[model samples]
Target chain A: AQTVTQSQPEMSVQEAETVTLSCTYDTSENNYYLFWYKQPPSRQMILVIRQEAYKQQNATENRFSVNFQKAAKSFSLKISDSQLGDTAMYFCAFPDYGGSQGNLIFGKGTKLSVKP
Target chain B: NAGVTQTPKFRILKIGQSMTLQCTQDMNHNYMYWYRQDPGMGLKLIYYSVGAGITDKGEVPNGYNVSRSTTEDFPLRLELAAPSQTSVYFCASAGADTQYFGPGTRLTVL
Candidate 1:
């Protein structure tokens, strides 16, 4: 069984600044996928970014990037030039390589507040 | 193309009541999943199906039931609901790797 952990319960960042949300997971499987999802007040879950375990290079999408350390079983999300829209509940998720799809294990979310 | 859709955005049920959370996807995805999200907590998988007529238990399967009689619909059932079952439920579908989610259903058990 894979378990994801998010240490930060709540985080605040000034608009236009940068913020990093920490995440760690325990898994023995070598092939897997990691993802970052954002949930805003609308309650819609949106995919932020994703990183494959085999990919050594981190994944970056616009202002959202991930620091994936396979050896340490760590995958952290970094939001650069954060804006008010970035204020949401961020979740770290792990998906297995072989199984029924969409069965992702998620970590306790980190509620982020972007201050003006 | 409606990626994923869930019905009854919000509902309240009394103890021992039974209701079903309806989910549907039009992308012809082969995989469908049901997850529940607790406050300040991550989403926990309740049930999943790889295809029609194939269902499997997930992380938190107790107090929940699911059926996949067709490819487009996967409904979750909660029989004799309890206070512990109060949470927001989400339905998702996957094509290959990326999973698409619905708006979610918020259920409160009183």
Candidate 2:
């Protein structure tokens, strides 16, 4: 039971423009670990960028980039140029490395608004 | 290095009352986690530990109760509180795979 699907609940961009927040997961485990968390409003929970499903390259951190498509299990999160502090609440996590109390499966967030 | 720390950043109970939500970690990470973030949703796993007494049970562990006697402490117990157990409670620690958060604990059960 490894599920993480963030179908964009809310998103907006303008500052510099360029936002892509969408994730999908069901995992059958072939090596796992993918994250993108950013919760502003002081609730601190940063750490935006990480994808390692045997690594196929996709994974940046400067402007945050990720498009891992492990056989379509998809894991997208790219926000380039966008500023305005990037207005937070973006999450798409997974840590079900076959599970053993590794716990970390979230997805139901995407409320970014970088309008200005 | 206050890597992970969760004390009483914010708390308010009433339903049945009973508290204990404090986590600490100086980065001696061996794995420790307990999550819950309800408002807008996204983050639910109520217990974990892989060092010190070894505790487990995630994906929402009933009412909740945890303890990791060492390796930097990991405590989360709410014997009778309800209201869907309010929300906003995060405390994590892990070294071999990224995970270090703790600036959360906004429980409120009225």
Candidate 3:
């Protein structure tokens, strides 16, 4: 079974500051893909960033970046220069293609509040 | 392109009623999925399709049903509505490893 865990249920960060959200996963598959999705008040799910297991270099999309440690099975998201618009729910997901293809296992999520 | 779209932005159903949630994608992706998110929880897979006429059950697919008759449409059917079925449903289409999602359908059962 594949499980993604997000320990912090809620978090807050001041504008222009940096905040890191923690995530861990348990999967037996040697190769896979992980993703971070953001859901704002509008209820639209947006892809924030993605990390491939085989890559050693972390993935960065503008102000969003990931710290992926394959050996420790930890994939954390860092938001640099956070803004008020960054307030949303963040979910860490892992694609479990075991038998059933393209099934994503998602963490409970961390509600992030960006205050000015 | 309209990536992915779902019909009925909001719906209210009574117990024992039946309804189908419509989903379509213009990206021509081979993989489509239906997922539901309960309050304060992450999304759970309901059903998925690899392509036309190839549907499979997902993690939480007991009360829901899905069919993919074409490359662009995957509709999920709810045979009987229940209070537990009240949640937001999302449809997504995958191209490569990335899945693009819809705005989501909010369904409430009274």
The numbered model that scores best in TM-score is: 3
Per-residue lDDT tens digits of candidate 1, residues A9-37?
99999999999999999988898789999
Instruction: Rank candidates, DockQ, best first.
Output: 3, 1, 2
Estimate, for each residue in B1-110, the C-alpha lDDT of model 2 and write its tens digit.
67998999999999999999999999899899988888888887788998999898887899888989899999999999998899899999989788979999998999
Between candidates 1 and 2, name the one with more favorable TM-score.
1
TM-score between predicted and true chain B, model 2: 0.33
Off by over 4 Å in 2: A1-14, A18-30, A37-52, A59-64, A67-77, A81-87, A92-102, A105-113, B1-14, B17-35, B38-44, B47-56, B59-79, B82-84, B88-108
Q: Would you list the rank order by TM-score, best first? A: 3, 1, 2
Largest lDDT belongs to which candidate? 3
Better of 1 and 2 by DockQ: 1
The CAPRI classification for model 1 reads as medium
The TM-scores, one per candidate, come to 0.94, 0.34, 0.98
Clashing pairs in 1: none
Residue pairs clashing, model 2:
none
TM-score of candidate 2 to 2 decimals: 0.34
- Candidate topping DockQ: 3
